[model samples]
Target: MRSFTTIFIALFCLGFVFGQTQGNDVLAMGRKVKKPKILSIEECKKIAQQEYNLHLGFHQKDTANYNLLKGAAITDWTIYLGIDDLPFAVEFLFAKHGLGVFTVVVCMRAERRYDILDGGSILMTEVLKRHPDAEAKLTISCLPQWFDTLRNKGYEVDERTPYRLYYFENLSSHFFVVFDLKKNGKREEVVIDLYNGFIQNIMPEWKTLEDLKRAQINFKPEPLPEMPKPKEKQEPKGKSSFPPEGKWEFSVTGVPGFLMSDLGKECAAVACTDVMIYWDNNGYLDDSDEQTYANDFCAYWGTNGRATYSQIYSGMPYVAEKHNDCYVPNGGGIRENASWAEAIQYFEALTQELGAQHPMVLNDYWPAPPHANCCIGLYGTGDDKSTWRYYRYDGINQLPQPLTVWRSSDQKWRPTAYVSGYCVGLPTVVWTSPLKGDENIDIGVQVQIHFSKKMNTSSVESQITITPEYARSYQWDPEQTTLMIIIQNPQQDLKFLTQYTIKIPATVEDITGKKLDGDKDGKWEGSPEDDYLFSFTTRGPKVSFTMVPSTHIESKTGCPPPNVQFTKFSRAILENKERRPFKVSFTAQESGEGSYELLVNELNLPEHATLCTLALKLTFTGNYHIDANANFSESIQGRDGIQITAPVDASVITQISCPNSPVPDNDWPDDNYSITNPSYPTPWFIDTESKVGILLNGFCAGMGHLLGRFKIPTVLVNTDLRILGTY
Candidate 1:
């Protein structure tokens, strides 16, 4: 909860030192002196109860919505906003079923924490706690002014709908964070990087488009808070809901334990930062600048308690790796909900194995009230593991001791571990193309590997080898977080329908010399101990005959005729109670009643330039004799062409149509809008990365059609995006 202003008191003393800031505001004496206008509890309560609504000037619908939960049973309270308690919350309240269909959770923290896009983290956490297994993955608004600004900034911006309208004021765009893969435990989603995996952004789904537009009228960003100072370790007072199955007396001196002063403080982030700071001081880091280097890595904890890997490591002055990256066993190998003893055993083994008595962070993943702490060192106050007084960061003391404070207003706390970001750990493979067990990969597809941390490029490159090898070219992103291996020399490409395995030796290390913890066992046995491996089988060389009608076009003389006979089908599916995967089945056919001439043309295999590509090679030879074929290739940027089908778990109205297929409904004045300008040309986008279906309607000839649909790869890859994974 410490302020940047307080942290920069040293800057005030230096007259000549130009303060470098990450904000648009200028510094006082070179450092930005932002004085937060935080109201007092009484002031905030008064405003929330009265003056706030006047400031917002809500219209009829909005005012009604705002007051729906205010006059009665609304749960209302105030807290410091952002990572710093800089601005006090006026009031955050949620009356069940007040806003929209998002009936379960409606919570708010700071102005910067609310999201106009996806529902925020608070909602996701609540949904996880309730549904446990539901995949919870935003907005109605307009922003012409904002779009113009973005356009001038060189973004290929054509539009920014459901955009934030205002900034600052009470209607300002709020702060938010996105978490992926699994950080909360097994019950929680997996925590992978942005390139691949499920993601959850702490967003609010209650506000209407109009309300959000009002808020984004002005723009203001959150400022950084200084690294919190650890206090003297104190035994926390209270009983935990979950009892310790086994007790262990332990003490680790010089453990930097910090107390959270703000309401939104994330315990695990605090504990992990403490460990990293301790590492810097204790020589565990190669480059130490007091706590500055550690602060650089842990700054996200103070802003909103969560950050993407690039958000945390990119552009930092110091190296992205450390002698030790606060390793977790198996990259969160321990189930988040594992018992205390299991977590202890894992960390204890990890610490002892590393041979450096580093502090460990613990989190319970308790959504209602998540708690975390950093354990300094292992010092048993009792004889052994069976008995020990636990001194935690929250100042709780736990043992066989029975202590209650009903007379006091102290809060109950849980000390546990989420395992993932609860501590920084060794690098692990976050995602890959032609995922393990994929039986239909393309022989010529480019393989991609996404790592959790920046890597020792040479260490990983030299040690990686593929079984049933093919001539391949290896390349990496600037950050070295992603690797792409292309099967080179079409003559030496892999065999069709053959399974292959990628082997990365355990000796591979991140930039700081930390070896890969492939098995996540938290050990460094070298060789096979931490080797990483995955296998995928390429698609067969032959085509199938199960295609269905997926295009709308009529042919005459082997060319498309003016009128239409092809039908378009679209449906909106929510919850997808059927548990269906993203798949569409369609077959291509060529038929007509006349002397037919069929022509075959050899098209190049999928290329990265087209993310969605149709692989069939047959075409109609004549003009209006009535030719018909199915091809749907779109997306020229070589990005994820098929992902355009639908967003993960989000409600979608999928419409299947062939490119250049006439837009249905007769909304136009004429069926042929280009009649007067018949030279106007229409084009069908070709998805070449994976595979797609394309139908060409021209005069008919003796022809045979293929039956099959494109198998869109979930990940978009390849620089040229030539061909994606095996289609």
Candidate 2:
């Protein structure tokens, strides 16, 4: 063996040559070769010590001193080694497994002095290929020089302006050393690239240490106000110390009148006006002047100044409609006979359900004048008698104050009179006859309008109209709750299969002067232009057939007469059109040894003649007829041999007519028969070869024949004879 140094050099040269050959092969194949195993922590430490001449005493003592910095999946591993008594740390990164070193990072603390000899240099070919910014041959370390240069520039470097070393990624050989300078409350950061030995960038500031100190002295603070001292605690009061605890009061606002001087005299109208305003604020009614509402209410109730509870109740619905609100009244004197206790219970329940206080009109009958005012609240008084407080509006004041009244000894409350009824909003259209989109309606149908409450007939009549204008008469029920419109002598019977619409204009009002709430949306859908419309279609005319027996056969050779069948069919031919399909069928029953033949001429059928059985099913397109010839041959042996009856000749005339007209007679050839000579009629003959054309005149043309003339309207008809004979 050669010497140790010579042997190492020879082995390295041979391995390098082999790696070059293998790399060429990998490139040609467009594939990577298998990577070698990663170096162990001890192996990396030993290499660092040998290459850099470093005394890594603490790192060599334990495996914990070495930490593996894992790279991205595509990159390789980097090992960080921390040594004792050394100001700088070392990072070893490998490329493509452990084939070779990618880069090395020497990190130093802020107080430590940096040296270029701290870490060993390594070939950065692989790292530079992946990152062009990496240096292939880095000769000098700029970290220590950078601090010296900052000192030479007369800048202070202390704990507040500390420095840190950062290694961004394993792909590059370069790293950044960041220095932070503090002055006043602001920080100025400077970055220096160590690989190229150059300062990357800096944030500039004009202030020096002395300047910052001067600025700090100029700042001053403002004084804050002193807080108040606490007070002594106190106990809660007992319920008995005050009035009854269960007592509740309503803050119902009062409304003054526009026309009348004393709203107390017109309390019903005033209370209603106030309630309307309250509902308007709650989104139930539209806003309007209180005085205007009062005037309208008074006029609607037909009262000069004072109005009855019934009148007020009746007029509220109109107010609700006009304001686009709903009004619901307790009908039929519900509160008129209620006692004091019952009245209080009713008010309590009502207010609780409504979730708010409402002004109520009081009728005091016991007070002679039966004065009316608004009841706003109720108090428990701690006795059998409750105190009822009310707001009374006298024309002079805008907002009235509440007045209290104690219950009478007889248990009656103030307003000593019985509690009268009240009304809330409820506006709607109850129902309509010939409901929306109804079809096949009778031409003479009477349109009916039923409202939730009695309507003003005159107003409704003026607003009601029909499409395709027709003469009509209006009639109202006794209560004026339902309106009936009778169509009189309508033009062309309301036009067959035509749709007619009935519209009620929005201007139509109820007995209380409220307009129709067409859509029930709590708002009027405007007037005249936006009306409620409903439509219906009238039934089309009908077409049918009425068939009468034109011929019948009597018993022949003691054999029972054969039965004949007739049928008719009809159908609509087009959409909404009166083109109906018409069909007629005639079938004759067969007797013993008898055959029937039917011949049709000038008829819209598939074939002219049919043999074996007397059956004919014919269809017609319009007003047209078919001439049917029937022949029957019956063979019955008796004393007389082959006794055959004369062939029967008959004519069937089908005529089509209008729906309102009768069917007219269709002309046919006259019968020319010599009864005395007993000869066959002209144009009537018997075929000897087929034994057909045997006319049974005894059942058709001659005397004692069971046949008669008939007619049909808008239909198809058929008449013929069936002969019976003995052979």
Candidate 3:
């Protein structure tokens, strides 16, 4: 860790000399200084407060305007905070302002080593014992321009430097680092009192060009892979299929390896797009014949020397000729066996390079079938460690980000993955439009692949069953030789999502050979080749339908939020409609002057049935008409119309009506409020000379009740709304 920090400090110093030049009296006469004396926790706090106050300067207000530090639980006794981002605020007590902040993970013990790099202390030692060949290391990489924005705004960074080292002095062994940028081609070192993780003094160091170079070389290394031959080529007959126009759905399986995979141009005939492939490893893949000693490194391991690369070139001809991305597995591939810091570094570089247009796929589905499972990665040793693992594409829509801790233990991985910025990697079937031909003719069959950072279990890889639900009666095509699947998401896409992850499973085999088991055990298990593992989603047919007496109108007093209420309602289900039946229930609110009516149109049915046929059965089908009507109070009246009618004035009794046809209900109110002024100057009613009067206006309020019921023309679908009383 110390070595990496040293490297970062060295690189940071070069920016000022090569590009810009600035002068500052504070940085003049810079010279390397000796280490300062240690201070108590209280002394550290006071220094921090003073510097913060000075930074605030005239902007400082009362105590209410004081700065607050963000805290993290690193251990039992020590709580770390970040206070470097406040430039506008003044720190009355400190020496100067800093551009960065550090998060110190301390323990309850009062004393430990100052600098020793094996791990940390006895606590870390015990934890390191779990990971056999792994060693604790720190990373010292810098955030780019955009990320620098947040870093400058006070975000704390982890080990990403080579200068950093574990030192043991006095009582405690701690990992310490200081960051200070210089303006005159010199380095500034801030004396941070290690006694309590706080800044104490500052000194300028004038270094020879040679010294600067040495510092840079001492800096931390970027988690990157060895650059491969540029301008790689894609395989011919690329895996993905692009349709000419319209809504075309396609799926790809077994894309060439990254080393020889080519991302085809947009104008290419067969375009091979970039996709994501999750790399994972558990001890199960290690056979006794391959390695003499093997423990589950997935559960524990920490090391820097394990960094290596595998050149995974495009294997399939379709991917080799058409696409053009040659992937180096170790460098560009997901690094699970490395230390957490190494994993983080690897992912950061990989994701930044890949950008968008990448797809993620879980090649090896684990934990067995029937039961759902997901995976996670945790970093650090002892109590200072954290878990921020989740499987997700860097920038995917409607995806949940990962959480540091378990939110729930639900059987479904959807909730955890969806909620935690994780991407969904469930296998799906892409639905393309039905081809025009004999109903018996088969268009195409394909499987949709989703990349997950974590697989529920290896069970999915055990056995897979792809079966048609309602189409079971048809003479289905034979399996295995007739169809096959391909996997294609990218390597970089998976690397960033895992922390402390292991190597990916080498071969993904389907235990089931596309056969459906009546007992539902078609899922793969560790069995003989009698069954082939196949993964697929159940699909169904599309249908549409209409409801009769579609309109329902209501008018009542005492309304609530969605104010308009219907005291009387009626609906007519249309007969001879081809659409399926879906149940819909609605209630309206009635209150104050805020009353407003509601109308639902084309509400979609939920996908609840495993079989499309069952979905058909659940919905109302065949020619049939049904009318639903109910009256709640005498104060409510009913009338039929083409649209919802608004009441002109308040009244104790109100009537609402709906149409009798199968059309939807929102079109209902015209009939109830269509009374015209009869006193108009028509040919027969020449009332120009005398004062004329309207007939319906005078008794409009009580006309409905007095007439018993208003008989009006009914349309296929209509509704009327009336107010029971004035708001």
Candidate 4:
């Protein structure tokens, strides 16, 4: 027993030493290897092909079938290659920074098929480890078992559905498995960690059938039958079909059956819901339910009773504002007294605009009970006084029924005798471009306004007013109901930094003569006469400057000492002149008369004139009138030394308005508002080219120091300005 124990210990020590040596050799090799460098596109393709073949033990010779795609993120590329005689393809992702192999994905082309490789990460790690310099740290998140697991979890995934397996790097590595749910056409994306098989998240990719087919790899769809061409024969001039013959009964899917509700008379609500649901199914709107939509819409329009054309027009904007994605143009109520011919025209227009046959909601389908229904189809024209057939939806209990109405000699339909009025829901614009209060508008910019209903061109043209107006032309898009005002000739290219107001009065009317009134105020002011006002400030010349109170000067001194000599002091003012300086001074007064003074140095005085200071008094603090000759007398040189004359006829004005107080900074009136921290710092200056004053405010702090700055664009420079104190 003792001899056996000794032999066991010896064997254990030998094994430990060998293990340590092997570890040390590994560390040495790692240290000797340099970091990998980025590989060229061709080199990466070659490496990927080699790795794939070496691991699979199959030589793929169809190099032409390889596709190289650059990733959306930088320094990432994928090489996709197909296997010979197999309905599968291999995708290799390479991180360009270190030429690292991120992942390898095998995708099958068969429907409902999963090309998951067991121990795919292990295989990748092994293959990458063959390179002495490579740092292989691969993880397989898309194993074949995941499909079975999802199926067990009640997810409908099949081989017929398209899927994608890709790798992404965001700080750390990750793998994604994306597959379509064949039952509902929704794409499911599952994210998993690269190092572990744990799922990080599962999200749905909202892609349409066409989008999926376009993005799917190796997806060759079956050809569709060609559409039959229309016959070349022209119909008789007076025998035209309103909806064309065959298209009268087109079906709209996903519309809910009409149901009576305590929520209110919901015919309009149901009809609107039908249109919304149909559009949603066709991928034009987000998913929504009819009850919730109707409830919300009724609440918005204040509809407690029977909905009318006025209410529909007013309420349509609210619907658009809430569900902008589902809002369509001309989708509001038609005119109350619209003629049958007019109604048919609008129906045809709506169908063409929506690119589908949409049902038209009629307020009074049955005259006896004042019932509402939808008109789905139309036939024949009023030109020949022929009978018109309307495919109507009465309720969910029955299919659409054909109602025939004879056209009288006056081009009127017989339905008018029983129905009081007609109303059809249409689309409208609840918003517009160049939103209100927009500033720095370009001089050459065209004005665009969107509307919910088709407008009467003549009415809209007459109601629009552009202040500081220019010669403009109008462009109307009947389909979009968008009015574009083009500046044929602007008034001096729109003055820079000047505000221009666009007024669209309530006089504007829609095609049905209903004035614009989106607010349902029982007033015309909401639409054509609603006094819709919007203004924008044109950008000033790039090179412009604004005068502001100088913070540095104001802080150090109070308005020029009451009686100090003007020549000896440095007056806070702006002087811009070639030879003679033009000085502007601001002064404040408590109760005494306002005054203006002019002083010139003896050396810079006019050659023949004597230099002397002149002062003029004003009665009030406001702007005073100045007459050069009346304000000052000619100069007298030393009581008769030479009788040098001064220029008294100069165009200098004696009226100098008392300067208002400097405007406070934006951060003023804080808890620490004090004289010690005067509202504005002195010496504020702004360049017009970069900065612009948007608003100026001021109060009297002392005499002659009006301080304020116009707000400017924040991007140009610092927002704060120092007002210079001047006297």
Candidate 5:
């Protein structure tokens, strides 16, 4: 009989190679190897086309030797699933008994560039939308253990939530779970294990629900029907070209004293074809202390040139007269004594009945003004040494002209030599020497003082004067005390005792305005006519600490130690040029002798950047003192009853990865890096009896490998085993 049916299939291939050398038992070696019984659906579509042709020949033979060049490369995900109008024999009997008999063959890549691999066809479209006759037996059988445990985890990890968690453990026994892989998604928890899956656990405690009615079905958010509602056209209204007395546009620019007090409060109506009255002081008037800026711009608006003709025919009309006549015989212009056609006929008789013009608008960043002397540069000046410098352009253009810069009285800036790309006003400059009683020989000049952009502020309690002048042989030095207080915006791992607030400054008040009280012995009580002088702030702005070493180490007991600290005057150690510091040492996860403060949180900066203060160096087997804000909530302390709180001294320790681990390589450090150390302040136990239980390692350097887990609650040798590593 065909050689007795080949001797009964050669004794079932010698009893499956004698049950795989039966040794390190996984159920006594898959129970004497028989398997292969996924009955119907065309034998699970011939084993999902032989596991997608062996995952397309190992992704085209390991994508031409991985990391070609450096970063970016992944781009080949063809997962088409099935369904739509069914009928290809009921979509091939529900994709071969629902996803080719619980799929299994998988493949993956990515050893760097932020390891990320995600789940496949979202659990075969949630098992064929919940099982249309078990969609040929659910994704040919659970999408090959969900893409072979996230392609054997190799970097780029995130099967989703808490790193992709979905328990389901057990719920009685009548389980007709058809489909639900995130319907109307927005998840945080969803555990259901129905027993056969070994009591699956998904309990990292966190609540706040409202919907997802236990995923039995009935989910919402689908709405997109009634297509026929788009008809609302109505707009036939008119009459309004916007000009019933609002368009007398007149713009000029030669230095109109920084544009007359914000353009006279933005042109408050003049009523005559609309209005727009602007001016310019290119005729000289840039306050440099001339009797305190002409007594504060003559107590407010009304001097420094132009104006006067009944104060401009009574305030409002329309006179745009940008100034610039070019004259510097000891500069100080009012037109250096009128001449540009008598200063344009005294500015058209002060805007004769409303309407004047002159250069109109040709500013080019501000030009015109260069006719005396010729070559004296400097540049930039808006304050501190009163801006305005450039002297050398007599007439034929070499750039720079309009001159008249001043503002002296020790604030300095009196350089008169105008003529090139103009705009300078400090006036006051003359030498005209005949040596007549020469005290450095000078004629009639000194009138260059200015300041009048509509001033206002003079009642300083009636300009006071209470002289006392009384001094004898006084000696009150408590050893000559020295004061110092300055601390603002310091950041770089700063969080020791945590408590910050500083405002003080009422100009250091005291003469009753309070603020200088430290008495008893901290000094300060106040006496030199005390005018507020408490200040206090120097011990702040400066923090630095370190610890980084986890580009994927996984085992070797627990490798991570670099130790670093810095505080009050701890020089510098540096490292966050894009963040890296992550070593927290362990100290049995802390408990008593108080001290763990590591809270470093820089992330997204640049609003005027400022974060510098990190000094952490804890290397003690006992006898510590470097908490500099690494504060581990008074160190753990939760034995026996097990309820320990407070332990988040952070420095980057967010573990919770599994499905095999390794996903995210470009050498880890993102999600904005740094923030996870002995960080277990709220129930992070899992180490049951410790066979090195809490391992979760995933630092990444083409390392992280298992990417598909979320169980937690460990025990190890006593037989708990839900270890599933990486973070």
Candidate 6:
């Protein structure tokens, strides 16, 4: 009986071999194989352990070693599924996924070979979230083709909505699903297009709901049995706004600013703090202060200037699930494991304050020491990437600092390689002209509102209320991203010398229906606490000032030698023979509206030489230009004709002529370089220039150049100007 059983088993083995001999590589070739059953991580690791050992043996014998997988070796038995939802591959993690993720695909077949995938690919994490009972086929096609093969296995990609857009409005959604199941037989996959709206199909052959309607495929199924309500009454649960239709996007006001230096190179934490401050101020969290939040965040994540991406979601993501008070749900961030262009767009949106107006922490992988910074804002007009404006908040002295570009994804114009770390919070308020507390503004000065995103014009217009009400007309830019309010002079024209205030309530919302986050606490309340209230003083009808002639004299101290002298012997010798500091002294009254001069030809004098003050003239002007009521000193430009200079253009440097006119009375010309003179229609200076301080350069022996430094005369426009109107 035992011999008979052995013979039967041998015959079964021969039959399997015979089936493969017929040119079909699949083990169950002519037979229908059920969809591979979904298994837990433990089950998959156990199933793939044998293959893992085989690869380990091969790595040992690979002496010639052409493969350049440089990292810590791997021996984990992990399985990953392709688009068809079948486990046909095992991963060999070198250090971590994406850095050196080696996959032995088609492992059950003799033709199996190694393949690589991006470390940040969503596929690594998407496996468990898939429908456990998806209808699948055991097809023999390679990767890209499998995307096409998925259709045969009862799965179809909505061509209208690309897969990359899955994160558009729904960060936690992996596939399209129909909420109404009462009238369905077998459910078909539905994909929501962020830009094009939602598309639900009832049949595989039909492309849209309209097609299904035309085909009469809407057979009525029994209604899903609804659960009965309890007899006892209870407080209604918070109605979730998720999966309502599309992504929940918003723009917050006042994206807070912080320097990495303030927190010890923890840009990720500091960036988080910016958004947190906004939320805390808006009553989202009960926190101590920004510094404490940042310190605690960095300490919890162990983000010692590294692991930025891992630090975001695990560190401190701002969302509804994390903080119930916040409006958006599911932690409010998109689940994107992206690099290159994907990463670039993520940070770009963060900078543009479009889509998700969240504070972003991003990486610069191309730099020798790859680094990251918080992207606080953007300053571009059109579609040009070159024109797009994004600035680094960390290490910047001001909020509008220049964009810190580490690399470009294309490896041209900028460095190549980047890692998109994480996104949170939001951005609003592009900029405001005649900034807060600005003075000398024209009575008819047009107020410009550049929103963080395209706005709904009606919402913004209805909310605008100017103080000391004046007749005004509105003109919107072509993109609806900027609004200009053209102010007309009052009937009495007394608007001059008065402070004007433009108040925009927090009720203004963008095209996406996200109200302005007035306080910029990363949340929207539409309350007065979030209102955008900015004020600027108008120029007086007559502007005037006189030069107060004076002289300045000083000596340079602690000026180091030209070269490095930190060596022990060098420091000892230099400390004993250090030269005495040189003297810098000068005086000025007036030269020209757009011109000034210095007299530095007599520089043969020894350093540290004390000198008597030189004579200067005083002048006043309210005709062609406004005079700065201050004296110019040449103490900066120790010697030479560089004492006085023309302040006409930002770049041009026309030095005062060498030979002095025998008459110092006509020393300077009369040309107005003053920026826009309000209250006076055409006062020599155009109504579109920066304020000019009529300062003349003088002598100074200091190492630093006074080339771009000068007295910018601000008009003493009325000190008692008051804003007396609101609507």
TM-score of each: 0.28, 0.31, 0.21, 0.25, 0.15, 0.28
**Cα RMSDs, all models:** 30.0, 38.4, 26.3, 32.1, 47.7, 26.1
Which candidate achieves the best TM-score against the true structure? 2
Ranking under TM-score, best-scoring first? 2, 1, 6, 4, 3, 5
Task: State the lDDT at 433 in candidate 6.
Answer: 85
Which of 2 and 4 is the better model by lDDT? 2
What is the C-alpha lDDT profile of model 4 across 388-475, one tens digit per residue?
Answer: 4444444321233334343222233433211111122222335556778898788677888887666778888987888866567899
**What lDDT does each candidate get?**
0.36, 0.40, 0.22, 0.38, 0.22, 0.36
Error of 5 at 228 (Å): 60
Runs of candidate 5 with Cα error greater than 4 angstroms are 1-499, 508-583, 587-648, 651-727
Worst 10 residues of 2 by lDDT: 568-577
Error of 3 at 322 (Å): 27
lDDT of 3 by residue, 1-727 (tens): 1234333443443333223223321121243222222334444344334322222331123232122222211111121111110011111111112211112222112222111111111111222243333221111122122234324534443334222221221111122234443424555542222321211111213123233223333433223243333222222243222111222111122221221112111101101111212211111111222111111110112211011121111211112111121122211323223454443343343232222223232111111011111111211112221222222211110111121221112211111110001111221121211221213211123332222112222333333332221111111123211122221221101111111111112223222212222122423232333222332221222222222123232212111224222232222121111122222322332322222223332232332211000000001112222222211111111123232222112111222223223443453343223222323231222111223221222132223223323332111211232111111
Off by over 4 Å in 3: 1-213, 217-283, 289-727
Q: Give me the runs in candidate 4 sitting further than 4 Å from their true place.
A: 1-254, 261-265, 284-286, 301-305, 324-355, 379-387, 396-398, 407-727
Candidate 5 lDDT tens digits, 656-681: 11112334455333322232342222
Query: Residue 247's C-alpha lDDT in candidate 4?
Result: 17
Off by over 4 Å in 1: 1-255, 258-273, 277-423, 490-493, 543-727
lDDT of 4 at 361: 51
The global Cα lDDT (0 to 1) of model 2 is 0.40
Question: Which has the higher lDDT value, candidate number 1 or candidate number 4?
Answer: 4
Question: Whose lDDT is greatest here?
Answer: 2
